[model samples]
Target: MLKALSLFTGIGGLDFGFEAAGFTTIAAVEANTTVAATIRLNRKWDVLETNLDPRRAVDICSSTIIKDAGPLDIVIAGPPCQPFSKAAYWREDGASGLDDPRSRTLNAFLQVIALTRPKAFLLENVPGFAARGHSGGLDRVLTGITRVNSTFGSRYRVHWAKLNSADYGVPQIRERVFLVGAEDGRDFIFPNPTHRNASGTDDDVRLPLYTTCWDAIGDIPSSSDDSLRMKGKWAGLLPSIPEGENYLWHTNRGGGMPLFGWRTRYWTFLLKLAKDRPSWTIQSQSGSASGPFHWSNRRLSATELFRLQTFPQNVKCDASRSEMQRMVGNAVPSLLAEVLACEIKKQFFGAKLDTSKSPTLAVPKSETAPRRTAVRPVPPAFHELVGTHADHPGTGLGPGAAAGARAKRDALRKFKAA
Candidate 1:
């Protein structure tokens, strides 16, 4: 079996995925003690409870990992992605990508490649990591890998793709950028999507139907935990939002109240799952009003979240509800990982895998979704909030963008003054 080293090993999604595909993770690195403990709870891989962005230095950090796990056949990392996420774009100062100090983790990941000289490396991040103007970090990564080739006299070539988890039958429509490369200069081919939209609109018939929410969690027993109850002022509004709809449902353009403007709120606001459709992306940092809520008008239970991410059923999370969400939300879908790992083993390591077999972690198909619930009328209390509200002007022209520009000007002024 090929040996692997895991970085930013949140909830063991990537590790579990690769393991299912015949790679053994010898050691895993994670920054959060709570999250690391959760990983240790399930697996026997040596858990290094240290931040990858080391206080010592990048080279020193790599040395410690090497000392703990020894030489590696591969290094896999999902660096902190906030620096390149959509939330970062809406921040007061706008998205900084690599300029954000947190992005040092990306450099640290590359440095480990230079030091360990793994036969292959895989890096995962939010799609914004490879966005045209926001992809400075990607350039740095390619250049750094090239340097690793020149220094070690290895022929490393990189290939990347933005893949959706649903395309691989993971039951969620989460998109992430995956970059993979090997020391032999062999161009890695990303797997063709094995699933396509189940919605009968498309003519493509070569692939299986997309795994849906019901497919993933329809069989799991519902939890009665009070913690799963929706909270906050907007909690009551969730039921009125139809299945697979969000705050947009209450906007002027929708079937309900004109309580909001088009494109004014974040996409996940009061979002609820439809039994028949695949889920939207699960978010790591969710507000009380943020969603992808159960069609039953409640927050998803831990097991449900895990199933949607295609994590094994027996894996236990010992953390609080919010922390559990953060760890699981940040995870790469295990099914997606398994798909990539199988391809990697075949292409890079010459390992034999039955290409015709489905990923072991893929959720089973369910023939029927639960009956849709009735949409409730807007509560009388919220009727007062209905009125004419302006739609967001456009990207970089919205109110948030104006605020970001002002904040930038103030920062520059302060810097000049100092």
Candidate 2:
């Protein structure tokens, strides 16, 4: 069996996927106590409970004592990505650009690959890692890895692409960048997309339909956990908002007098699932107000979020609700990881590509049907207004509608000031 090493192993998502693809995990490294505990519970591999802090060098051979594991076939790591995350960039108070200490984790990952001399390595990170501003960092990583491969007398080829988890049958629209390198100098090709957008009109019917939010969590009964309830004045307002819609639906043009304009709020602000579409990206840390609300108009429970993240149903994660949320959100969706692992096995390990056993979900045919009966009714005036606006374009409200919305917003402001 091929042996693998996992770095920055958060609850073993990548490890689980590679194992499912027929690789044996020999050792894994993780820093978080809660996450490491979860990994220890689930996996029998050597779990190195130490931080992969980039400021200090990691002597994986001596420190983790993995030198005796024999030749490792692959190394997989997901370095901390806060340095290049869009959310992190948005939250920054000033224009410091792309410099972040967390980015050094990438260097630490390369150092491991250098020391272990694995046959191949896979690095996963947020889509922003490939952004124009971070291209210099990416170049440095590439150069560093090349130097390491040369020192070991192996010619390695590297390839990278941004992939959406939903394309691989995970019921969430999470886009991440994956970089794969091989010591054999063979360039890695990404797996063909197994699923397509629900609204796409491609002629190939053999390609599966994209998994939807309902496909993942439709069968799970609603949770009575207090953690699943939305709070504050907006709690009641959410159920009345339409599925796939956000707080913008309650703005003045939509028959409510909220001060915020359409598109002014974050996508997850009052976000609710549309049965037909994939769920929005599950956040790492969500408060009572942060939501991708259930179509039933409550916050999603940890179990439901796990389902969306493609973790096995029986996999129990023992942690506080908030910590569990962070683990799930930070994880690479197992289905996506599995798809990549299967391809890696075929390309590098001589394993036959097997589509017959790929994971799949049978989405309901009626997913796109109106969900009016699912939640409390909105006021008649607001309902009528929203019904008309829903037909516009781009969630039924386009540029022309934006102009009218702005006018209404200004008028409402005047009325409120009076």
The number of the candidate with the highest TM-score is: 1
- Quote model 1's TM-score: 0.95
In model 1, which regions exceed 4 Å deviation?
A: 54-70, 93-95, 199-203, 413-418
Q: What TM-score does candidate 2 reach?
A: 0.84
* Residue pairs with clashing backbones, model 1: none
Number of clashes recorded per candidate: 0, 1
User: Local error of candidate 2 at 173, Å?
Assistant: 0.8
**CA shift at 209, candidate 1, in angstroms?**
1.1
Worst 10 residues of 1 by lDDT: 54-63
**What are the clashing pairs of model 2?**
393-396
How do the predictions measure up, each by TM-score?
0.95, 0.84
